[model samples]
Target: MAISGGRIVIAFVNVIGLALLSCVADGAIQLAGRKHSLHIVRRPRGRNLAGGDPTVFNVMNFGAKTDDKTDNHGPFAQAWNAACQNIGPAKLVIPPGTYMAGQLYFQGPCKGSNPIIVEIQGTIKGTTDISEFQDDGWITFEYLDGLILTGGGTLDGQGAFAWKHNDCRKNINCQHLPKSLKIHRVNNSVIHDIKSVNPLGFHMFVTMSSNITVHHLDISAPADSPNTDGIHVSGSSFVDISHSKIGTGDDCISVGQGSTKVSISNILCGPGHGISVGSLGRTKGEGPVNGVLVKDCTLSQTTNGVRIKTFSKSTPNQASGIVFQDIVMDKVQNPILIDQNYGTSRKKAGKASSQSKVKISDVLYRNIRGSTNTSAAVSLSCSSVFPCERVELVDIDLVYDGTGSTKIVQNPTLSALCMNVKVKPGEHGLIVMEAKVSLGTL
Candidate 1:
């Protein structure tokens, strides 16, 4: 897998090769990974799966230690309390090799029936001695309703022994380095064929869960590893991430602030930071982000593509029905963004407050085509005090192959940067960019 100009390049990865027999999205199965076969999520009407004859429970029969340094978190919590006291369908196997674990929680309301599986074929090494990570997740799965985490194993968060103590992005009172799978408040769950590597932060972190169903994953990290985000959804609600192959450094899927109906599709992001919903009103009872749907993704060399960040000290509706359709932006650097003055400080985002209170509304960017290095290919720096309502831009085809020294060939400056949102910002106005079909570049 190597494409130079159009950039793909990922030789191999597929840890166990992802396999989810259920959770119907109508049906389509080609499941390969690393270099892509994608097309998962479909065929499910069977609620909370893991049906009949399960009863496995074998973490080397509760004395787990694959010689990888012997610290299998108390034999994987005594094999998940004997498969959560096995009542019906149960299976908590973690066979194969290399195990060094430190914080393996897995608490549940489980007494069996309605799935209680946790396969993990092998290699779960995360104890580089970060003081045994007293929680912030290193494989935690709380109050599970009906979990069915898959196998294709590999959750190695050694993160080069904690990426030089990852100073929480410039030391904002740091000290939070665990994260290598933490699905809190787990409800009807289904995490498929996994393979997350190098994490000390954000690599599959769904919060306050609802009907969760993360798919065929293969998340990695290395691009100077800063934030390591690859599938992070906060406050969750009916979440469903799909056939993933994320390369992280940050935000290869980040929907923050009380997320709702989140559903990202067949993604294959790159040297990260793309696919976001919010920087979000910088913290203040911040909630309310409704229905988000990012579609068939492919963002190579990413920096920002398909984004919506808010933080002029936000939180009102903050965001609403957001959709980014059939995307494919290689050489990306800001393919399409909407930062309602995100983290200030460009002289505080050019003296911010174009009235910004956050509050965004029905947003959409359809069939977004690729190639942009940065000539500002679409940015709606919003916030004339809560602006951004029904925004639309259909079939946007981008192109501006920047080679660096501001290099651009043939009539460059492919622009789109509106301030007062090109419409109105608050008062819940009819703010829309309203582009139908053809709009510049390419």
Candidate 2:
């Protein structure tokens, strides 16, 4: 009846394995703890989209109005409203004319038995100060099953002057954020092949949605535009964004709080803050973000390539299982960054309320090959109590243009590291024992 060491180890391993398996099963079904009751692939189109049937509705030559350049709202709104309401398996087509509208909203139950595709050939022209922007939600989709928006046309936000008006000197309380499109609680939606330009605020904001796929979309905003994140996804799960080009004032992709299972690939970002995990915090109580993966992306002239920022004072519910792999950085400020203490003000930081609560852990960066303009290529700073655990770096080759102190700084929290880090001539890569971990080498 003697318990040997080997048996004890085996028993412990088995228990851990079971726990992991259970977690995977739960995540696979529920999807990042959102409890979203939607499935990715729909059934076809017999009565209830029975076995993956394709349903196409065209919005062409079916009651459209004409508008002059001076008039911004005439035919476009008429066509969109009509098609969105009348057609089954809807396709709100914008044919090759300049149709104008103030604001458009895609209301509830916008789905049929088959996958819905909204094809556009013309454009959805927006008005600057029609006063409808204040009232309209600009394409709001709620609780829909599946949506496909494929078009060669554009959705012009006409938001430059509106943005300036809101940013006036006197109107400090003006909350004029002009978003091109907004989607909420939609499951398994696809928005692609479309051009979105000059959004007043975030180009596309996805909230409380799941299993969304955004591909081949081109989003652009002026460099000086404030709060103009290309794609701002919040409280969503299982998002796959790929093969897209985004350039904006703020982060190209800002994964806000309560977002998880985010997989991004083949993205080209420039003239903006690179893809980010957070600026996570602000509200009194909040949820965590986990299971984020970014790979095979390219960044150019971006402030930073990969970043995770949390407030120093605000208590983070949980953040784990984040990874960035196969990234190409071009003139990026800092290719890798992890800041645990994230928030606006450092004076009021949140505290960890309980031990059972989750913390940021298991962040990995691998296969990052690139060059920077004149800055550190890697920087990581985690929480003091629950320091980033299991931080790994494999096959990372980075170089600076000049001798910009290519060195690696080692810290206690940074354990189990394999830095094959190198830099240009006259630069030093070293491990500096500073307030946080700084690992650089040549």
Best by TM-score: 2
Best by lDDT: 1
The TM-scores of all predictions, comma-separated, are 0.34, 0.72
Candidate 1 lowest-lDDT run of ten? 21-30
Report the lDDT tens digits of candidate 2 across residue range 375-411: 4555555554455544544445555533332442332
lDDT of 2 at 276: 93
